[model samples]
Target: MTNKKMRVVTCPLTPNQLHDAQLDLPKNAKAQAKLLAYFETTEEDFVPLKQLREELGVSGQAIQKLVDNGMLQFAEKKVNRDPYAGREFERTEPLALSKEQQAANDEILLAAKEGRPETFLLHGVTGSGKTEIYLQSIAEVLQKGKEAIVLVPEISLTPQMVERFKSRFGDAVAVLHSALSHGEKYDEWRKIERKEAQVVVGARSAIFAPFENLGLIIIDEEHEATYKQEDNPRYHARDVAIWRAKRHHCPVVLGSATPSLESYARATKNVYKLLELKARINQQEMPEVHIIDMREELRSENRTEFSRTLLEKIKERLERNEQTVLLLNKRGYASFVMCRDCGYVVECPNCDISLTYHQATRKMKCHYCGHEERVPEKCPSCESEHIRYFGTGTQKVEESLAKLIPEARVIRMDVDTTRQKGAHEKLLTRFQNGEADILLGTQMIAKGLDFPNITLVGVLNADTMLFLPDFRSAERTFQLLTQVSGRAGRHVLPGEVVVQSYSPEHYSIEYAKMHDYHGFYKHEMLMRHKGAYPPFYFLTLINVSHEEERKVIQTIQDMASFLRTKLGPDSIILGPVPSTISRIKNKYRYQCMIKYKKEPTLKNELKSLLEHYQKEQAKGLTISIDVEPYVLM
Candidate 1:
């Protein structure tokens, strides 16, 4: 909330006020029911009745019923941008960049000054002062009286990124993300629409900020799959930004420690101007990465969750009063629960996925559909008292850490803990302020967190993503490990990383351990070339879903047949195959993949196929087409 003040009559009238006949109240039952549902929802103390009606699609009489009843009352609604709003920034200035950073900054500044529509790939190593270049380039954009848009991949990164941008630009920056309340988002959006905010910062959708003269667009962590929207419109923010930059005659800088293969290949071919930040700020050495083979650790001792080396590192960080970041990458107490005797795994009835065991609530929950059930003492299938939890998650890791090291003050951050609004900022602030000895979380904590005291980084399961059946699995594993490892030794104090993995000798893990991105890129490109994956061929995945398995199968098969005929024999058409998790929320899914080089009418043909199924869509059928999908499964 950034607005100043307004009389928002949101609170319901008191019983005494309702008794007063002077107070007009709605007599309609529908209005009363709408008012009842509105009050049931936990909302802020007050909201403008006009705004509430618009937001809820309720009639004025419906809103009046709640006010007429003892459910809502009138009060002044003050806008609050953040929980810690109105705090004074430190008036910090951008640091002098190293030679590589200066070159990158100059190139971008030149582009902005010349008002040219250029796309540059800021291919920088982690901790290479890429943000400094961003700040400097944005400064140039502002100096030219033009707006800029910065897109981050996750909301978790927004707090820190916004802090840095706001410190430099003050009130000129406005943030927009899904994490913000409706009112909060509206205020920020208005700031941009009214030309009050010169710089717009947020995750993904910030690319669509309504700025007339956008001079520069920056996509930090551009390689993130989160940049791609999974739902309708299905726009990739990077691609959108590039398109917009062209429209506005601005520069779009794609910055990432590990650029995606497609982007890097384009850079190699001189399609994108490449700029590299080769060294860390102040030339601090990269953290020493120790890839501990979990197989050897298991052979020595049956400690499946944590290896001896990682445990020792955590202990050392605790003993020295230095902060540590432990990444589990998974949430809940256990990944999944199963019966030991019958080997019957608990599964979600609505989806083709297992239920994760949450220790706090003693509930088995599905990660896909939010289906939860009480953890039974006896197995429902086998009638045996051998039901047990398996696999390590963030919660389990946290419990083990606390039990093993009683003196350590550990803060656990995961989906469960951060489900509430402002929880991410609160936890990160507590950790950043030196209130917590160790920060443990999922991928949320992997990147964009810059705490100087965090000298130790431990990755619990580095090989989990490595086994995923996708072409980019190895690339993702390497990027994740490398990004998480970059979290350590961000400042003056030297740092180290302990990565526990069963596949210790895998190319991704080994390359990550050596901090060798170039070598890994080369190796991955070789595999991609041979496999006919991205950068070599364009891939489109067509998914057909329905309640009936037969319908889903028939739909995808028919679609695949049409694609094979329409696109001709040059294109490879694969599968009406069942999706990896074929059933989700009672919907059966089958997918067809098309790998093509270049087909002039491919997009129109696909659009036509989608249109053909529009009539059947009302009969519980869904056709989703993903072009250049992040993952096929």
Candidate 2:
């Protein structure tokens, strides 16, 4: 619902009049009591009039009579709920940029000044002052009487990022994200709509900020998959930003240390202007990365989650009074529970996946469906009493750290610990204030964090995403490892990184150890080309799901048949097969994959398929189309 202009009513009576009115009590004791309550209890100068009448049980007539007698007075005033109402920032001035940063900033400023709708890929190494270029460019745009929209990954929108923008732009900056309350989002949106805020710093949705004179758009950490909305009305923020930039005749900046393959491909093809910042700011060295083979550790009779090298490094950091950031990328206690005696595993009845054991809750829970059950002593399937938890997670790592180094203060961050409002800020603040020796988390702590004292970074399981069914698993593993590695060695103190992986010799891990993005890109591009994957051929996934498995299959088959008859030989259509998970929340899923270089009629054909299945949808069938999905599963 649109938030219309709201008016507040305030008392204009003096203290003397209030005393006189209280001494001579009005006949409507309830209304008079509410008026006194507001005056005595609330520090707010005004209360919304509608709320006062409805919630405080104040009668309009009683208020009018009180106003007439000069015992009280009411004044209408506009009110807005400011999200950052009580926060104050120390203003910061622009910093002197290096030659590379200055050149990038100049290009961006020129584009904004000339109103050219150009897309520039700012491929800078981590800690290379990419944000400085963004700040200087936005300043130019704001000075030109235009607005800017800056998009950062939701997980990367830490207090540090928000503070830098807020300190620089002050009240002119508006933030939008899913973590904010609906009322707060509405007010922020209205602020932008009313031309009150000139710069919007938010997650993916901020691309659509209602700015009439938009000049510059920046997507930081542009390779992040979080920029894609997976649910209905699905869209990629990068695509939307470029679309809007063209409409407004402005420039869109895609800044990342590791750009997505599709985006980097476009840059290589001259579709986007490529700006490179190879060296780190202030001549700081990139973190020295060490890839430890877990297989060797196993052969040496070591069974701990941490490799010997990582544990030694952690202790070294602790002894030197430094900090460490550990990335696990998993959040629960264990990946699954299994019975060694019978080879039986506990699986979620609602979904086609095993239930994860959350040690804090002492229950096995489904990560996908929210189904929970008590950890059974005996295996439900085999009646075996040898049940055990396997695999590693953030919680498990935290527990291990406590046992290994009792004196090391660790702050564990994940979805569980950061569910509350301001939790992220509070935890990060504590770490920044030297209250914690180690910050352990999942992917959320992987990027956009700048902590000076953190000299050590560890990856407990670098192979977690290395072998997924998805084709981009290698690329994702490389990107994540590279990003997390960048977290250390960002300041005056030198930094080190320890990556533990079962597949230690994998090309992705080897390249990550060398901090070689170009190597990984070249190697991965060949794999993609050989497999006919993204950058070579665009992909579209058409999913059909229903309660009945047969019905789901039939619908996908029918759609596949229709597509084959309509499309030319150049377009390849694969599968009317079950999806990776197959069944989620008791609904069976079937998908058809479309790979084509040019199919002008594909969208219209897909729309017709949806139209044809309108009747089936009413009977519990669901169809979803993802043009360029981040996750195939």
lDDT of each: 0.86, 0.89
**Predicted candidate 2 versus true structure: per-residue lDDT over 139-257, tens digit per residue:** 88898899999999974464677788999999999988878888888989999999999999899888889999999999999999989999977999999999999999999999999
Model 1 Cα lDDT, one tens digit per residue, 101-136:
888998998888887889999998889998888899
Over 4 Å off in model 2, which ranges?
A: 1-71, 75-78, 156-158
For candidate 2, report its TM-score: 0.91
For each candidate in turn, the TM-score is 0.88, 0.91
User: Which candidate gets the maximum TM-score versus the true structure?
Assistant: 2
Q: Report residue 36 deviation for candidate 2 (angstroms).
A: 14
Report the poorest 10 consecutive residues by lDDT, candidate 1.
17-26
Model 2 clash tally, residue pairs: 0
Note the residue pairs that clash in candidate 1: 11-72, 11-73, 12-71, 12-72, 12-73, 13-72
Query: Can you tell me which runs of candidate 1 are displaced by over 4 Å?
Result: 1-84
